[model samples]
Target: MINYSCINQLKTLKDIIRYTTTIFNESDIFFGHGSDNAYDEAVYLILHALNLPDDNLDMFLDANITKNEIRKILYLINKRVTLRIPISYLTEESLLQGYKFYIDKNVIVPRSPISELIQNCLYPWVKNPESITSILDLCTGSGCLAILSALAFQESMLTATDISVEALKIAKKNINYYNLQNRITTINSNLFDDIPIHQYDIIICNPPYVNTQSLNKLPKEYLHEPMIALDGGNDGMDIIKKILKNVKNFLKKEGILVLEIGNEYNNFVKNFQNINPTWVTTINTEKSIMLLNQEQIP
Candidate 1:
């Protein structure tokens, strides 16, 4: 219950940010979508609503904010606290590795560690990016990774697929936003069910790996996203198992697959007792993403 009428009292950007942090903390709000903590989230929300450069927080910390602008910002904060909506959905945009993408309720926010992996072109795994000719991004929400991979491997053509048609619309919108429609194609498929006869140099996926037990403990903010992009069944390997069994067909004999199974490392090992995947090192953790070559699969 934010006192909307008192918004004018918080007149400066600095004032609003402090107030937001206090309010967010008092309300026990969760923050894992875009920003990691309340201070960063406050800065992002206030700066975004004010239509200011996100990086110029220091320059505008004490700058005066108009009453109408304060009202609008307060409205957003209220929605964020009371409704527990993610800041990206509230702002209608998300940033991954400095690249901005349009986001909405149809897809999850662009927060994958794969963004860093792709930004680095997969490092030692793939020494040369130009040699990559094709890429497939499964569960490509908002086309963030698909578009990022296309940018990373300039010579490669990308096919981004998702089971939800509504999610595909957002992905296509983002692809066109980056003017990558020419380099990326959108497919409506459940994993590999409808994928055409094509093998990719790289097959990256950030599928639904949240176990049923963990689903019950998820923060309310996560409920704002499409659950099809989150729920991964009882053991969290429902989609992972399918991908493991069939990804070999879509991956070239010499190619690699980068899969992200957030917080499911133990379950992943137990599910695939025979498979040994090279855990890809990310800023988060090595277990967050895994890399497997063609021979690694059965």
Candidate 2:
């Protein structure tokens, strides 16, 4: 039988995992009435404290963990359980399109489903895609989309534009991290301000689309992210509308624009009652992403 006193002062990886599981169960009561997977969150905290790679937990499931490590992990777990802070902020990293990008409060966590479309190269719509020589990622927070674009389309030149200087700083770090400085250029601009007037073959955006009403309802964990990246005015399509109106000027005749409007799809359609007939909509499990060809715009 395990001694309760000794268990409380765990010294091995095994001990820490066990303790974390226990604390997670106890903490769940505080998280909410019927929360599931609270233990997973606790385990993440443990892995973080150890500075362990994401797969390390699986590799060392039975390995011993030190007592001091248990204490530190427990403290972080408590902070998350009590404060409702997102684990991403604590970890300073997030995954997108199977690639890891460094993250902090300076930029929103990378969680766009647009990754799926990108991975497949926007098939069915983008035939003879060699024509896509230049691509633009507007509102390119953290530069995840831009970096991923370079990785996706090796032959294309990429430009990532953002309005926030702080966001641009984080994006630059990611660009440098991926060593994509040669293929990717970071610009500080509100939409198309700094972007060249020349046409682009593709423009991808996951812009701010959260309406004020929805913003007020966001969980505390979401509040930890940058509001400038989330709030999309009263109807949430303020930025989307602006982009739709001005995007035609920057696109080649055959270029396509892909826009991610999270949770604001209905409002978007309502605002733009006569959406371009050439525009096609793809609904991911989480949201609706619209694609419009340059020729369809005007």
Candidate 3:
């Protein structure tokens, strides 16, 4: 437990950040959502607590903080370290490709690398983003990617599906948040079961790809998220294989499928050797996402 008596000592933003970092280091905290370390996580929580912008952090480093604000900040910091909750869930908001959306335990945090492909308008993969008339966001947890896809492919109408009714409710809220109710529609489906027999120009998905072994050993932060959205069976390809087997049926002759498999690239390649996909790289690394044309599905 954090000593509330020390809250008065954190006068400046820097002081709070330093103190939070020390507390974070002393605790067993995991950092997978956006941040990667204690110092960065401390800064994130502090900035979020102060209701400040994340971009211009340096300007406010010396800003004086009131004791009341300090107490609030320290409480959250302790909650973070002790409870191992993700910062995004604590704030109930998350950013994907600069676009902010409402988030909670109902859906996984929006940190998919596919945001890069959406930002670039699917680029060399699609050649003409204007030609994409229909899109499907399978397993659309929070509708972050679905909304972003709608923004990028302006003319396309989207069908965002999720098996979880709770997740679909959150997705609907996000769609309405972006005022995209006219462009995006939500459906409760187990993959393509509830989807009508309509082929789409593009089918995008960020499904659960964590293998059983990894799921069992996941960090405490992940336990707070929905297990159904993170478990991918024995090899993390259970749902992926199902998609690979039926995606062709839902894609047009010239349509494309953008799928994110996370760290299961090797398993994906080894299993689907016949289907050659263009491994897309984000700003960080490659093999996280793959693009496949209808013809490539055999």
Candidate 4:
């Protein structure tokens, strides 16, 4: 039997991993107490505790670890399981499109599937790829989308706009981290209030679309994140509607608008009649990202 009291006495990576495995086996609180894989979480917690990167653990998996390290890892695990704080929040890091980005309460954890679409340059509905000289990322928390845009389209100029200065600070760190200062510009704007009109070829947004009803129903782990980053108003489309109404003025002819509406697809579709027909809505297995051409705008 693993002694929970002794976990705080561990010192090395090996010892911490062993203790985590033992504790996980004895308790039902593995990986948010769901059927999800706990081993990955255990590994993440252990690596984070050691202040070691994931790659550093491959060589030491079978090696002996110390008591002090086990204790630290256990303490973090206890906080995660009991307090329900997201592991990403605890470690201040998240992986997106093969790169690790620093993250915290300043922004939502990077989990948008749009990264894959951008990398592949596969938004088929787009009319003119070459016309995509400038791209705008609205509601650009952490500026991941804008940073990735600059990296993917080296010739394209990018602008990242967010209402929160704290989120902008984090986004700027990512821009500097990727050495993309020359191609990407960070702006503090609620929406398009400060952006030049008819300038961008593509406008990407992952706005807060969680309606008040849904916001109240979010999991405890989600509650730990900034509410401003998640709450989308009463129907969750308040921000999106505002963007749609004003986006056309900012997009060049043939430009495209991509909006990520996670679970609010139904609400979006319900409001589709209110939206101009020129904008097309695409629904995938996981998300609904709407696309609209500038011509579609009234």
Candidate-wise lDDT, in order: 0.92, 0.78, 0.90, 0.75
Displacement of residue 99 (Cα, Å) in model 2 is 0.9
Query: TM-score for each prediction?
Result: 0.97, 0.88, 0.94, 0.86
On lDDT, who's better, 1 or 2? Answer: 1
By TM-score, the candidates rank as: 1, 3, 2, 4
In candidate 1, which residue pairs clash? none
lDDT tens digits by residue: candidate 2, 34-85: 1236666666667778888767576877777666766567667666767766
Model 3 Cα lDDT, one tens digit per residue, 1-98? 88999966778988999998999888888888877889988887888888999899889989999988998887887778789899889888887788
Clashing pairs in 2: 11-65, 11-66, 11-67, 12-64, 12-65, 13-64, 13-65
Q: Measured by TM-score, how close is model 4 to the native structure? A: 0.86
lDDT tens readout by residue for model 1, 135-249 = 9999998999999999999999999999999889999998998899999999999999999988899999999999999998999999989989999999899999999989998
lDDT (Cα, 0-100) at 147 in candidate 3? 95
Candidate 3: pairs in clash: none
Whole-model lDDT for model 3 versus the true structure? Answer: 0.90
Stretches > 4 Å off in candidate 2: 1-11, 18-36, 56-58, 276-287
Clashes within 3 Å, all models in order: 0, 7, 0, 9
The model with the greater lDDT, 1 or 4, is 1
